[model samples]
Target: MKLFSCPSCDQVVFFENVVCERCNHALGYEPASNAMLALEPTGTAFTSVGRGGDGRQWRYCTNYDHGVCNWVVPGDGAEPFCVACRHNLVVPNLADAANVALWQKMEIAKRRLFYTLLQLNLPLVTRAEDAEGLGFEFLSNDPTSGQHVMTGHDDGLIVIALAEADDAEREKRRTAMGEPYRTLLGHFRHEIGHWYWDRLVRDGGHLDACRAVFGDDTLDYNAALQAHYANGPRPGWQGEYVSTYAGAHPWEDFAETWAHYFHITDTLDTGRAWGFVVNPRVDREDVLTAMINFNVFAPTTTIANISDAWLALAAALNALNRSMGAADPYPFVLSETVLRKLGFIHDLVHGRVN
Candidate 1:
């Protein structure tokens, strides 16, 4: 995430900020330009003071009325929702105030996920364009209807359980599942990985290469999952997989690893935006000396280069969290084998098959 500033006062503004605190300029994210613009309402539409000086009027996404989104749709565009919200097919009933609150939280995470996806310049097709293009459904467990919603991806549609938005509920599940970290954004990244696997690996004619790196995805998924839960993760799983859940099947391994790649690169981008640099004055190991001055999302960034900066900064972040009597910000370790898998994903995302 690049650092944002209010065009009115140049005050530092975070991604989720809707109003510039200093100048009180209303703000909205311009999805086309990937910029947070200070808005000037002109008639029924908004004229961005930042990049769209072309007098291209824009309107906030319909969801913005509910305070759920800050993204804007071009005034001339026919879509009611922004690029991110357009993917949502079914949302929890907002009649219940609780559901509204949960949906708000989910939208925040979802927008952040979209920001990263847009930053990576990944293909984001709507279901209207492709039958298997990306879409979302946020549902809740309804006992009366005997409807239970489990968070998972099918085809190109990703369903998220509304309860997952509750931090306490998510933490309970994390503890029960013996997981190190879990978040709404993490869930988005993981499920979207499944969608991309369909688009990029399975259909993109790189299944053979992906199989070599992630193991044969043709293996029986249900059986693999059953054995995984029954026996737990294999011993020394850390060396090969990003998480114990990743070992369930080759598809999962790819998804989990893909999620981590996003985690590392996006977090590294945030660090860079904050002007963070790691040049330890002590020991100064060669691997820890890489500076984070370059654009991490650039296709030229090698996986080895990413790992170098990621490892050093993640260590510092973990230590900072410990100093504050909190859990490590990043609890996973990347072994050489895992790094190789991440390299494959990096290459794949950049459209390099060889």
Candidate 2:
């Protein structure tokens, strides 16, 4: 979420850049340092050409072969994939060209999700490490069998439907679900929230506090969802939930609120990196005066600071999108209840809470 520069040429490159355009140097993201380093070929491995750890040998994640990833693992490490790619349990069948492209798009979003998680210093254990650790299965619908895959989480495995990669298909589902916004990154954030609920709430012994904020998650999830779909959200649901779907269950409320916290922090981090300042000289409102001068990624950042900056930034962004006749980039409102839930997640991630 921060600006990256090519170590070789000092040219600004993006997080997902595989090659530095200015110097043509190969690039790989180092998760430990949270940097996109320029690489120098050194035998079978590549040496980082960056500060602090220059000359460290590394290898691109195996997913890099499919042109889907640019993350690196230490050359001395036994894993063939980087920290991010290792979570992938099943990638789409690459024999199909369309599937290859879909997987690439999904990886882009997944890596971004990993970036934020890593920044938060959240635990990211693989299924190999823990029997129920976080993992992913990128599956596609089988047209021949008329079977469709749903995007959700079970235990710790997050299933991402490959169909979500297609813009038309995703948009259709978004409309059908009555969602204001939905994307591959959103899916990762939402599904991973379920995994975190298990780890941080159930296993981490924060059930009391979590239930207090998110409502009793013990309520029958399926029945709650069935009732919610049969009878839509309560009037003025925005006052209590971030989205209509969030009103379905206490678990869903937590996941939706958790996802929004990630969205707010990561987007605010990006705003800070870009040197964004929402000072709107004409409107002297105190609420619109965020300067985005602090690091949102820092553990010390408070929920108040994040929400304040995010409200101003989201307003500015929404106006920009409206100016161009586009939908609001961020369409959700953060009510006091939602902010309290977000604060709970913020505390949970920072280890301030169980």
Residue-level lDDT of model 2, residues 1-354, one tens digit each, is 899988888889999899988889899999998888889899999998855446889999998999999999998999999898889999999999999999999999999999999888888899999999999999988999998899999999999999999999999999998889998999999999999999988989999988888888778989999999999996899999999999899889989888898899989999999999998887666768789999897888899999999989999999999999999989988899989989999999988885
Against the true structure, candidate 2 reaches a TM-score of 0.98
Candidate 1 lDDT over 118-137, as tens digits, reads: 88889999999999999999
lDDT of 2 at 45: 94
Clashes of each: 0, 0
- Candidate 2 Cα outliers beyond 4 Å, as residue runs: 50-53
| Candidate with the greatest TM-score versus the true structure | 2
Residue pairs with clashing backbones, model 1: none
Considering summed lDDT, which 10 consecutive residues are worst modelled in model 2?
47-56
